[model samples]
Target: MNSLVLIAVGLLGILSGWFFYSRFIAARIYQLDAQFRTPAHEFRDGVDFVPTNRYVLWGHHFTSVAGAAPIVGPAIAVIWGWGPAFLWVVLGTIFFAGVHDMGALWASVRNRGQSIGGLSEKLLGSRARWMFMLIMFLVLLMVNAAFATVITNLLIQFPTAVIPVWGAIVVAIGIGQLLYRAQVGLLWPTIIGVGLLYGLILLGNAVPVALPAEIFGLSDRVVWVLLLFLYAGIASTLPVWMLLQPRDYINGIQLFVALGIIYAAALLSAPTVVVPFINDQVPAGTPPIAPLLFVTIACGAISGFHGLVSSGTSSKQLDRETDARLVGYGGAVGEGMLALAAIVCATAGFATLADWQAVYTNFGAGSVGAFVTGGANIVSQGLGIPAGLAATILTVTAALFAGTTMDTGVRLQRYVIQETGAITGIAALKNGTLATLLAIGFCLAIAFGAASDGTGGMVIWPLFGTSNQLLASLTLLMVTVILARLGRPVVFTLVPLVLVLTMAIYALLLQIGTFLGDQNWTLAIMALFILGAAIMVGISAVTALRQTGFSLLAHRHPAE
Candidate 1:
C-alpha cells in the first residue's frame, strides 16, 4: 500500500476519465445540441437562467459540488486502508457520479430547467415529485446536522480557524457589494479580495483572541452548534449572489491553494503508507466498511445532494447545453480530485508508518480530522511557519469549509419545505419566510439534541454517507426515469441506476443493523429514518419499472 501510488492512481483516474471519456466520449453520446432551447432561454430570468461564460459557470458548479463531504469521505475511507477508498472514489466518480450529474443537467436542459423533483413528476408521476422532495428535505436536514457538527468541532478545537472563516465572509461581502450593487466587474474585485483576505489571515495570527471557552453552560461544541444555526437562519434567506456564491468562489480558490500546498508536501516527504489494505485484525463489531464506509465517504463518490444543486441552482445558470458537460461532469471530477488530494495528505506526508498507525489505533475512525489537520501542520512546518499558528489556520479552514456545507444544506432544505408545502396544499406554508423559519427550527432542534447527547461526533460520519448515497440513488432513479421518457438507450441509465441502488441498499441494511444494535433512542429514531428511505427507494424503483413498461407498450401500439 504505497501512499504515492494511491495518490497517483487517484490523479490518473480523474484525468484519464475527464479527458478521454467524460469530455470526448460521453459528451458526444448525450448528443447535446448547441441550437437547443436551454432553460436559460425558455425560463429566461435575471436571477437563475442567464447565459454566462462557461468558466464562470464551471466555478459556480464546482463550488456547489465541492464541500465537506469530499474531505470527510476520503478521510474516513482511509481507515479501511486507502485501497477500498481509492477504488470506490475513482471508479464511482468515473462511472456513477459523472453519468448521474451529466444526465441530470441534460434532463434539466431539455425540460426547461425543471428540478429532479419536477422531472420525476413529468416522467415518473406526480406522486414521485412529492416523494422525492420529501426525501430531499430529510437528506438535507441530515446533511446540515452532520456538517454543523464537523465545522463546530473544528472551530472549537482550533481558535485560529476563526481568522480564515471571518476572512472569507469579509472578502465575500466586499466582492458581492462590488459585483451586485456597484456594478463593478469581477476580475479586479476578486484579486483585491484574495489579497485582502490573506492579509487579514496574517492579522488574525498576530492578534488571536480565543473564543469564550464556554456557552450556555455547555461545552464549546454545544455553543458552536447554537451559533451555527443562528448563522444559518440569516444566511439561508439571503440571495445566492450576495453571500453564498461569492463566498463559494473565495473558498474555491482557497481549496485549490490548500490542495497544491498539500501535494507539494506529499511530493517532498513521500512517506510510506502504513495503513493495511484489509485489517483482518480489526475487532469484530468494528463497523468498518458496512454502514460507516457508505455514509462516511458520501461526497467523493456519489452524492444525491449534488442532484439538488444540479437541478435547483446550477441548471438555472447554465448558458448552453454543451456547458452542462463542463459544469456537471467536470464539477464531480473536481471534487474527486479534492478527495484524492486529502488521501495524499493523510497517507503520503506522514513522518513515519508508525506514526500513522498510532494515530489510527489511538483515535479510531475519527482520526481523519486529526490526520488532515496534522498534515496541514506538517506542510506549514516545512514552510517555516510556527507549528501552533499553522495548525490553527488549517483547523479554521476546515471549519469554514464545513460551515459552507451547512449553509448550503439549510438553503436546500428551505426549498424542499416550500416545494412540499406547495404540493400538500398547505397554503400558509407557502410563504418563503415562513418556510425558511421552519427549516431553521428543524435544523436547530437536531443540532441541540446532537450536542446535548455529546454524540454529535458519532452521528456525523455514518449518516453522512447513507444520506448522501440515498440522494445519489434518488438522483439516478430520476435521471433514469427521464431518460426513459426521452427514448434514450435504457441500458445507459440502467447501469448507474443499478449500481446506486445496490450500494444504497447494502449501506442502508448495514445502518439498520448498527442502529438497532446500539439501542440508543437517537440511534433508534435515525434507524427509522433509514428504514423509511429503504422503503421509498424500493417503491420508487418498482414504480419506475412499471411506468417504463407501460410507456414501452403504448409506444409499440398505435392506439390503446
Candidate 2:
C-alpha cells in the first residue's frame, strides 16, 4: 500500500474513535461532570498543583508519554510486517490505550489527584499498594536506563543533533524563566522560542559537534551518559513549571511540525512500501509474533506508563473533571498518530525489501536509528532537502523525545520511592534529594552495570514493555474497581482491563522462559517477580469486582 493511503486511513480511524467512541465513554460511561471541582482548584499552589491551560496540559501529557518508545516499538515491531503493527496501533490506541489513560486520569481526579500507587492502598488494601508501587519503581528504572542509553547513542550516531538537542534545553529554561518570572505573553515568546530551536537545528548541521576520543579517560558515550543523568537529576529536581512543562510544550510543537512535514512529503512523493504487508521471511531466532508484538508495541497501542504520568502529574493539574477526557484520552490518540508516522517511516524508508530486512532482522537500539534514517530519507527525497541535514533534524527529534521521558521518569520514580518510604515509615528515604539520588543511582547501575553490550535500552526494553503493560493492567484493575465502587457501568474499563491483563501475563510468562533459555538470569528473575506480583494483584482485583458487582445499577456507591 502507498504510505499516504495508509496514513489517511489511519488518521480517519483515529478521528472517528476520538469523536464517536471516546465521546460516548466520556458522556455516558465516565460521566465527567464539569461541575466537579478538580484537584487543581482545591489544591491551587504554584508549584506542582497549579491550574493549567487545557491545551498546554495536553501538550505536556502527550509529549511526556509519547516519548521515543512509540517510535522505537513500532519501528521494531514492523518486523512482523506493517499490517499487524498498524492494526494494533490503531485498535489498541482507540480501545485499550485511550481507555486506560482516561480511566487513570478519572480515578486520580476523583481521589483528589492521587497517584495510582496512592489509590491502591485506599482501594485494594496496603499490601496491594506496596506490590503495585514496587512494580512501578522497577518499570521507571528500566525507562530511565533505556532512555539514557537511547539519548547517548543518538548523540553519538548523529553528532549534528548534539548541539541542537542541548541547545533546546537551554532555550527551554529561558522560555520558562520569561513566562513564569517575567510575565511575558505566551504567543510571541513561544514563536521566538520555536524559531530559535529550528535555527539551532540548521546551525548544528553546519557545525556538528563531535566528542574527542576520550573525555577524562572515559569513552565519549560513557561521558555522554553521565552528563545526561546529571542533567536529568537537576532538571527533574526543579518544579514542574521551571523545566518539564515549558520544555515539553516546545518539543510537542516541534514534533507536530515534523509530523506535518513527513506526511506532506509522503503525500506528494507517494512512497510505495517496499516492505510487505505480512512478512514471512523471519530470520532464525526471532521471537514469535503473538506475545512479542503486544509487548513490543506497548506505548503506541496502550501503555501502563501513561497511567503514571496521568496520575503522577497530569491529574494534579487538571482544571475540571471534563478536561480529563480531553487531556487523557486525547493525549493517547495523539500518541497513536506519532506511532503511525513511525510505522510509515520504518516500512517505507528503505529502498528495497532487503534493505528493510537488513536493519530489522535483529532488535536493539539500532531500530530507533533505522526510523530516524528512513524518515529523514523519505522527507529529503520528497522535499528536496539535503539528506544529512534532514537526518540531523529527525535525530534531534528522537533525542528530545527520549530526553523528556528520561527527565520525567526520574522525577516520577523519585516520587514513587518517597511515597513508598512514607508508607513504609522510612523517614530518611522520604527526603526529596535522597530519593532523587536513589532514583538516579538505580538507573545508572542498570544502564551501565547489567547491560553486557552497554546498550541497556535494547536489553531492558522487553522487560520495560512487559512491566509497563502489566502496570497498565494493574492500573486498569484499579480503574475498574473505582467504577464499580462509584455505581457506574464497568464495561468500558472492565473489557480493556481483562484484555491487557491476559495479554500481559501471557507475554511475561513467555519472556520468563525466553530469558531462562538465554541465560539472562537477571531478567528471568525480574520477570518472575513481576508475574508473581501480577498474580497477587489479579486475585485482589477479582475479589474486589465480585464484592462490588459489575452492574450499571450499583446500589451501594462508595464515597467520593
Candidate 3:
C-alpha cells in the first residue's frame, strides 16, 4: 500500500468527523449554549479557572492528552497489522474518543467544572465517587511516573533533544509572560516563541548535550526523573496562563507542523508499506488481538485518560460552553491524526519486509522507537533533511509532548488529593503545596519503589491501559445516566459505554491470569482492585439509572 493512501484517507475521515459528526453532537446531543455562563467566568481565579481563547485551550488540551500514547499505542498495535490499527484509529476517534471526550467536558462544564469523579458523587453515589478517585489516582500516577521515565530515556537516547527539550521550558515561560503579563497578542508571541524553539532545535542538533553517566551519587536517569518532578511540582502550582496554557499551545503548534511534514513526506516519497495487512507471524505469547488491541491503542482510539483531562482541567478553562465541541472533540480528532501518522510511518518507513521483521521480533519491540525512526526516515528521504536532524526533530517533539502531559498529570493528581482533603476533612491536603508534594511523593514511590532503575512505573502500563478504559466506560456511564434523566437519545454514548466496559473488563481478567502465571503479584493485586471497583461502580450506576429513568428535563436550560 502506498503511504499517500493512508494520509489521504486519514485526513478525509478526520475532517468529516470534525465537520459533520462533532457538529451534530454539539448541537443535538450536547446542546451547547453560547450564552451559558461558563465556570471559567463564574470561578475565574486566574490560576486554574481563567477564561481562555478556544484555540489556546484546545492547544493545551490537545498536547496534554496527546502525550506519548497516540504514537506508542498505534505504533505497537500495528504489529497486529495496519488494517486493524488504522480502522480502529479512524473509526474509534469518530465514534468513541470524540464522544467520550466531548461528553466528559460537557458534563463537567454543565455541573460547574466538577471533575467526573466529583460528578460521580451525585450521579453514582459517594462510594462510587471515592472509587472513581482511586482509579484516577492510579491512572494519573502511572502517567506522571511513566512519562517522567519516558522523557529521561529519550534524553539519554537522543542527547540532541536535551537542549531543545529544556530550552522549550524557558521559551514557554517567556511566552507565558508575553501572553499574560506583557499584554501582548498571540501573533507576535507565537512567531517569536516558535522561531526561538526551532532555533534551539537546530542548535541542539548541532551541539548535543549528554549528562555524565551519573550525577550526584545517582544515575542520570534517576536525577533527570527527580528534576522533572520538581519542575512539574513548580509548574503545577503556577497559574495556567504562565506555563501550562502557553507551553501547551506552543508545543501543540510545533506538533501540528511536525504532523504536516510527516504527512507531506508520505506523499512526496510515496513509500510502500512493507508490512502485510494482517500478520501471519504471530509473535510468541502475544495476547489475543481482540480486546488487547483496544487497550493497546487506547488514547488514539478511546481513552479514559482523555476523560480525566477533559473534566479535570479543560472544563475549568472553557471560555464558552460552546467551545466544548472544538476543544474536547477536536482535541480527540487531533490525537487521532497523530495516531494515524504513527501507523503510516511505522508501516511504510521500512524499505523491505526483512527490515520490518528485524524490529518485530516481539510484541512490544516497536513503540516510540519505531515512530521516531520511521518518521525520521521519511522526513530525511522526502524533505531532504539530514537523518540525524530529522531524528532530533521527532524525538524532541515526542519528549516535549510527554513532558507537558506529565505537568498536567501532576496537577490533576493534586486536584484529586485536595478533593480528597475536602471530603476527608484533612485541610492540609487541600493546600496546593502540600498536595503537590504528596502527589509527587506517591509518583516517585511508584517509580523508584517498583523498580530500582526509576522505571518501575512502566510495569503498570498494562493495568493503566485497562483501567483507563474502565474509567472511560464509567465516565460514559455517568453521561448516559445524565441523558436518561433528561430523556434525550441515549444510544450514542450508551453503545460506546457498553463496548468499552466489556472490553476493559475482559482485558483486565486476561491480564490478571497472566500476572498470576508469571507470579507478578503486584499488577495482579492492583488489577483485581480495579476490577472490583469497576463492578461496584457498575452496580451503583444501574441503581442511579433506575432512579432517573424516563425523566423529562429540558435540554436547553439545564439546572445548575
lDDT of 3 by residue, 1-560 (tens): 88888889888998899999999988988789999999999999999999998988999999999999999999999899889999999999999999999999999999999999999998888999989899989999999989998899899999999999999999999998988898899899989988999999999999999888888789988888888999999999999999999999999999988998898888789999988888878688777888999899998989999989999999999999999999999999999999999998899989898898899789888999999999999999999989899999999989999999998999999999999999999999999999999999999999999888798889786788899999999999899888877767677898888999999999999999999999999889999999999899889997877766533333433223
- The superposed Cα distance between candidate 1 and the true structure at residue 553, in angstroms, equals 20
lDDT of 2 by residue, 1-560 (tens): 78888899899998788999999888877889999999988998776787776766787788889879899999988888899999999999899888899889988999888899899989888888888888988888888888888888888888999889999998888888887789887886689888999999999999889899687778888788889999999988887778888888889888888888888888878888988888888777777888778888988799999999999889988888899887989988989998998999998988888888777766542368778889988998899878998898888888998899887888899889889788879999999899999998888777777664345655666788778888998998898887887778777777777777777888888888889999999889889998898788778877887787668444455644
- TM-score of candidate 1 versus the correct structure, residues matched by position: 0.89
Candidate 1: tens digits of C-alpha lDDT, residues 1-560: 55567777788988788887787535444667777777776777654456655655666666666656677667756767767777778887887777778877787777777777767776656765666676777777777776777776666666556666766787887777787679888788777876776676677667665567676677666766767787877777776667766777767666666667666666665656666775455534457575456556666777888888788777776777888888888888888887776666566546665666665662145444755555665576456556666565556556666777676777767777776777788987877789878997887666666557343544544565665677677777666565555544555556766766676667767766767787755665765665575566558656766565534212232112
Order of all candidates by lDDT, from best down to worst? 3, 2, 1
In terms of TM-score, which candidate is strongest?
A: 3
Q: What TM-score goes with each of the models? A: 0.89, 0.96, 0.98
Top candidate, metric lDDT: 3
User: Comparing 1 and 2 by lDDT, which wins?
Assistant: 2
- Candidate 2 Cα outliers beyond 4 Å, as residue runs: 363-366, 451-459, 552-560
For candidate 2, give the lDDT of residue 236: 80
TM-score of 2: 0.96
Over 4 Å off in model 1, which ranges? 24-26, 40-53, 181-185, 215-220, 288-292, 362-364, 381-386, 453-461, 525-529, 532-538, 542-560
lDDT of all predictions = 0.68, 0.85, 0.91
Q: How many backbone clashes does candidate 1 have?
A: 5
